[model samples]
Target: MDFGLTIDQKSFINEIAEFCSAHCKAIDINDLEKRGADPEAIEQKLAAKSWYGLPFPEEYGGSGRGYLSVGLLIERLAMGGYPYPGRLQITMLNGLNVLKNGSHAQKMDLLPKICRGERTMSISVTEPNAGSNIASLQTAATPKDDGWVINGQKLYSSGAVGERNIIMVAARTDFSVKAHKGLTLFLVPSTRPGLKFTRLEAMGRNIGGLYEVFFDDVWVPNENVLGEVNKGWSAMTKGFNVERAIVSAGYLGFSERIFNHTVTIANERYGRNGDSGKRGAVMSRLAEFATELQAAKLLTYQALRLADREKLSIEAVCQCKVYGSELAKRLGDFCAEVAGGIGYRMDSLAQWYYRETRIVTVGGGSSQIMRNVAAAQLGLK
Candidate 1:
């Protein structure tokens, strides 16, 4: 019933905010090809402070802070405009996936390094052909002598380009069984032979290094298999509930920053024109966004609450993901509209947000798929 954070939690959020203040500036990239604040360096700094383990258990060198704390951590980082916000979210969830599905030796070897920031990870699910339809994936892994040869193309595998990165790739291992049952998950090292990462130079994704990971007959030993072969559907979807809950919070936070900036600029610019009628109407429009933002916050927080109890509801996760991502998308356009010319500049965060929010809606699950899932969960076809 309470909608408040404890004193300790509030202070912890403040500490995270302060810790990130130095790295919280808008990305700076010169025409000379130099960019600001290496994403890896910032990640390592966060790791040194044990932040990458914000939601992990302590036995694996994590802080054991739980999912709700991680949601807050992600939101704060995104609010600060930290460039690697998406990467950190996936990094944390990838570790959680390994913990949930990896073998004991795999866990012992990887978890410590992951939590310590010596290594990073990403999940390669949505292939070019498989966006929302998991059953439609065509990527295949064939059994060879003592290992498996993987050959597939994955789209939108965020953060898969880093040197120490390992990607959890989903591939079909059998064709005779049901589509979901025939799939397997593998932890493929980013630097492994036959794996190529081509940066997708689309708008607003440079910060996350969104890439299409191509596997040209990559080989992985049996030990690299995550969970059981022909049973990867569960392992693949294990992180989505928490991802919707936590990553959606980041969307909310980024939306909040963009919303706040728009209001400031709108008020200042509109006030100067001395048109009280126009200014009042604009403020009312902003009020609508604010109300929707509150709704998003409630849904996201509820999802986080359920995750902490390990009772995450499919409906709750879908609601948060759909509403939060849509809000960001709509809010970005509105913010740009209200800010007018000033919002278009590259130095400003508004333009980047304008591009990024459009892509967020389709990342975890598309808004349409989210709605369908929520309706189905409620016994609706």
Candidate 2:
């Protein structure tokens, strides 16, 4: 199958590259390890270009770009050394979720803000006791006279810090049924009286650090419910496919960047060396990484194309996530090895990627979880 990008797609990528050149810089691994990008600044730059609306419908002030386009945009931005703007990533998926599952009023109120980059949102599903086993999440949302009362704790909510104004919370609304069937989704506001957030110290991707959020009898109006009660698992499943695909694309782009950097370093260090053996060895390793990166990119784009056609396949998405994430880690390892002692230093791009690659395997969904998903799709027990 042909994997060439269309002329329009190539042009758009070039535009993004130009934008990155003007507003973004090569990230400092040490600084990023401590904190994330400034949300306000990132928002301003993105909004100026109307990039915030790339994946949304035109009525929502978006550009009506397809999902594949969004994925390409993300990959290009990440490849340019941008932090990937956690809020933008969350907002893109959250907006799609809201558009698909939210009530009319919800869409009318939030979509415009999302398109304008005036609002930030996050998905809060993982809890202290439940990470990959989402069905086991204990967060509960009980119906009351006025609304639903939510009481539970969420962990590792990446963009749920003060930056996020809206959080799509997953909770158990019914206990009599199976855990997955009894769950519901709610759009809870960060400013709600009973909601609180505490930051979690993490090793990398420090911007909008991981958060531990506590909901103590927080009341959400019935209108805030997303999709049907107890049917949230289906909605979440669709969103997860989208999330994994975008994440995979981002990994592919970042890994390509790392590979390119390594090649430059290898050439600069060993270019004039008389020893053909050492030089050939480094070149071989680089060639292998380049081949893997290309394969991962194709897989990720295939998933995105499936999403565009609304034929999202769990197996394809899982394959992309697992392969792309693992490819990133492998590339990081190879780059670090080539850089030697200098790579271990805090300022080294190789060192930073090595640390950052750890999260791609764990976040969105772990590699183990992806394999299980693929197995299930194949009718394996």
Candidate 3:
């Protein structure tokens, strides 16, 4: 895979970095968590700039820049220090799913709205019982007179309901076939009757926190079924690869922030003793972190390339997810230790890094799952 980016791509990435640092500076996650706030102001700013359409097709009211640009935008946002594109990421990715699989009318109706940020989208996959094992999801959608009534619950949905927001839910339409075989994806309005959302308190990255969604007899017509019935799992798996790649990119950006913060603190502490950060041991460790971060970026970019081509290699994705998340975790740990008590403060960047980094290894296919995937792809017994 080519590591060099086009001049336009490079410039776009720099532009995104500047925009995120400037626009996302005021987005306080604590405030969002407390108030259950949605980042609508930031959302509107991105919309006006047409960034919400950066990667979709021109026919869908987008810039047609492709998925690589989207990944870069996310990476820059995270490195810009706040990394609060929680809803944006979810919307763009699930929008891609709709673009890829929805009917002609569904695409015409929803895709343009998605690009314009008039209709945000996300998934509700994790259940009280199912985490990484998506195959066992028990949400049921029974067909009734040309429509379906969904009845079940989901956990860790990204955002709360909005008048213009839609959520993709996976439900078993045919329980006769076991596991992933009988599931279908449906797009339902967050404001639809019988649908509910309750916020789930979380550690950090709490841009409104995760949510618990309840569906009681929520109904969607045949037009709302995403992809072919029973083919939902295929579309979902494809989107999972995209999500893992983007997440790895985010981790790469955050790893950069952690490294910069740690080094600055170390330099100041060492200089206080007149060593002027001339500590060779400290420098060596920092160098190691920088090297690892670069490697993670490479893996993430490679995965993004596969995502663009729509020919994702699961093994390659596992490599990106595993290495990038683990690298971020390591950098966060190292930074917290280097900064000592200064890092432990509630308001400190070090503490924030430590908290944010904790979730990397747990979401979107944990490190253990990634290793298992890699092993299977490698033909290991």
Candidate 4:
């Protein structure tokens, strides 16, 4: 497959890089981990630039760019030390799901707010008992008069921190049915009563930290049902391919940055030390990482292209997510080794990456879960 970037794509990437350089300084992950940064200003800046709407259709006040364009923009932003902007772009995934399964009124009311960055969205799937095994989620939504009353807890919901966010929560709507069959999605506003958010302390990238959200008799209107009741499992899973592709792009971008930083550290340490053996070995390892990074990039781009064409295969997205996430972990470890004593410092990029790398493996889906998905796609029993 040709990996060439179109002229317009190239120009767009340059524009993103320039904007990131002007507005965002490289984040100090250590500081962020201690006390989360306020994302309000950054969110507003990205909104003003229309970066949040890159992947949505123009009718929703978006740029009408394809998923591939969104992935490329995410990569460029991350590489330029502007990872937070990409978080805002994640609303596009929610927007896509809403467009596919939401009522026309729901779409009209939500998509424009998402596109304009007037609000943020999060997918609340993981519960205490369900991380990769989405079918086992215990959140319940019982039908009430003209609405649903939801009661349950969600864990590690990333963007559900503040009042301006809306979470797409998965709950069991029919307990008599099988776990997967009973599941349904609801669009719950964070400002609604009976909703409580408790922030969780994390190792790195804590700009908007993970949260444990409890919905105690939280009421949602009938119109807020995200898709057909009792069919949300399919609606939610249908968007995983695109979400995984974009996540893979973010992992690839962050890994590329880590790899470059390691190279610079290696060169500075041994480039002129006359220690030929050590220098050569370090260079060789860097070369291996570079090769892996390139392979991950290709896989990510292929997945994005397929998603844009509405032909994304489950196995393809799984492969991209699995390989790209694992590569980032490995790159982080290699950076730590190359940075030696300095890497142990809290402020070191290597240390920050090492702490953050595990999130990728666990967040979108675990490595084991991705492998299971790939095996199932291959008709494995």
* Deviation (Å) of 45 in candidate 1: 2.1
Q: Which has the greatest lDDT?
A: 2
TM-score of 3: 0.93
How well is each residue in 207-273 modelled by candidate 1, as lDDT tens digits?
6577898899999999999999988998878777887788888987888777887888787878857
Count steric clashes of candidate 2. Answer: 1
lDDT of 3: 0.83
lDDT of 4: 0.83
TM-score of each: 0.93, 0.94, 0.93, 0.95
Ranked by TM-score, the better of candidates 1 and 4 is: 4
Model 3 stretches with alpha carbons more than 4 Å out? 1-3, 272-280
Q: Provide the clashing-pair count of each candidate structure.
A: 0, 1, 0, 0
lDDT per residue (tens digit) for residues 206-300 in model 3:
66457899999998898899998987789798677777887788788888878888889888876557464456667889989888877888888
lDDT of 1 at 63: 85
Residue-wise C-alpha lDDT for candidate 4, range 37-94, written one tens digit per residue: 4445666888898988887778888899888899988787777776532457557778
RMSD of 2: 2.0
Clashes of 3: 0
* Cα RMSD for predicted model 3: 2.2
- Residue 63's C-alpha lDDT in candidate 4? 93
Query: Model 3, residue 230: displacement in angstroms?
Result: 2.4
lDDT of 2 by residue, 280-308 (tens): 99999888887888789889999999999
Question: What lDDT is obtained when candidate 2 is compared to the true structure?
Answer: 0.84
